[model samples]
Target: MHNSSQPRTDAPSAASEPVIEVRGLAKEYRVFDKPEGLMASVTGLFNRKSRVVEALRGVDLRVEKGEFVAMLGPNGAGKTTFLKLLSGIITPTRGSATVLGSVPWERTDDFRRRFALVMGQRNQLWWDLPAAESFRLHKEIYRIDTPRFERTRDELVDLLDVRKLLLRPVRDLSLGERMKLELVAALLHEPEVLFLDEPTIGLDVVAQHALHRFLAHVQAERQMTVILTTHYMKDVAALCKRLVVVTQGSILYDGSLEQIVDRFTSHKIVTLDLDAPPDRAAIDRLGFPCEIRGPQVILRIDRTRIADVLPGILRGQGVRDVSVEDVPLEEIVAEMFRSGSTAGTDGATGAPR
Candidate 1:
């Protein structure tokens, strides 16, 4: 696992001015209700019912020029909507945002040239063409000078180790290979700001790690500001120092990864290796949930009660070894999603209800 605690020493310092900024940013879609039967569908064509779905609400964020921030949330949490708004692919229904000193929705050519958006589920490259051909097309569309374009393309291809796959049609390559090419294509112009919506989704572990290393290296080398939305905790842990969690179309937590764990998790897992199988009733009397696995007992103890409960557990009949650990980050995030509560960063007890 990557040591996420260590900051990237080679990364350039952030510029004095923010590369991206937003205030009260929100988006809503009028989703028309579909009728099931033919007659009902015909009736609905004349009198359709519709409801508003808020994809983002009152979101405010500022990202410096060299920052790599991860956006995390469950499905239908508006993460993708947020990215589209930032990338100018979709206009917001309300509020305002600026990327690289220009309003993103304005879609100016200059602004378009300064950023890239990569969605894992979507393909920007032509399916029937070789990736090499697509690269050439990108060069023309971006009006990149021949020499500079070659230099950037070669460097990106080498970094991602996808040179051999360049001649293969995008439809012929594996998902992982296609994704690597996608990254290369997205970076051929060397965009200063990158918007990635689950770029590693559906990738195998090896591919995920490869992309992680490649992204970390590129972000550091170019000092690009990146906003990545992913459900994978490993992605957040391996790549980003800052984490912003969104759910129910609102910002729930915005802080360091360590801070999220410290603030939102209320319990720790305590494992006990005993001399022998312990009495179930006696363990139950301890007032914490425990699972007995042969000679080992695992207990989920509230953080506040650990100090009070440890001494008694250690003094138990067969107590021999004990260790305490925080609950897994995946579980913590899962609980947050299940609870659907707004979390404040003011205190340690600010866990979602």
Candidate 2:
């Protein structure tokens, strides 16, 4: 849990500027026809057919010097491809993208020094070495001065609560500990921008929250720019104020999480537990769109009409306990994919009675 009252003092230096700017960026791959039979293979070497698959189509994005943004999408949504393009591991087939005002695909030493990319499924650290040794290797690789490297390493270990794990071998450490060490390695250079692809993928709840708090602190204190692609809704809800939702190889929505909820879903679910089983039929007769789950009854009411209807619903239904909450973000995201209408940032305009 975050100490909400604690004030964050981290801010970017005045010299720092928009670290990432992308426009009309796209990547496509060609698939060649393969001969299955030996007889067919003999002739296919001379003649073949192929088709193009677009991994990214006209993706445009911008990240300010100190902003934290979350990129949300289901699997096969081209999120990984976009990150790879930005990391300079793969070149884009079309358009332009700039990291710290330099095209990453160029693989310039200067551009490489300005950012770090961490893929959850990939490990940059040496498996047999202690995690601390990995950080030392990164310092040498990045050519950081001795004093600066030590300071940064100490700060990161303290912030991430991985001081004890750093001395352990990477293979022996727990999954969460390895992730923390991986993060330390990624940040030892203090790149201007950070790209995190599911950094908390396999972490337990406690580890997840700890990592989230540490990231929040980094963003607040260092003013480090971040672009995170994650499947966890809790990650988005806690760490990101803005989001870019992608699906089917295109950016579907780019805005605040609050706005996403407001536009896609208009109903708030209210759960009620009566002292005695209230007249279920009478409650059903009120017709406010409800579903009963054993001892609890859930009512969906328009956000606008919640106050107006709550009093009456409680009075007539003899409610004993009630709690109100927005519809799950997952359901809203699913609806967006199903509708196939990538236009509105606000939710649909239906009001529940």
Best-matching candidate per TM-score? 1
Question: Candidate 1: misplaced stretches above 4 Å?
Answer: 1-15, 305-308, 315-321, 341-353
TM-score of 2: 0.85
Task: Give per-model TM-scores.
Answer: 0.89, 0.85
Question: How far is each candidate from the true structure, as Cα RMSD in Å?
Answer: 5.6, 6.8
Error of 1 at 307 (Å): 4.4
- Please tell me which predicted candidate would have the highest lDDT against the true structure: 1
In model 1, what is the error at residue 43, expressed in angstroms? 1.2
CA shift of 177, model 1, Å: 0.3
Residues forming the 10-long window of minimal summed lDDT in candidate 1: 1-10
Locate the minimum summed-lDDT window of 10 residues in model 2.
Answer: 1-10
Identify the runs in model 2 with alpha carbons over 4 angstroms from their true place. 1-17, 32-49, 278-280, 340-353
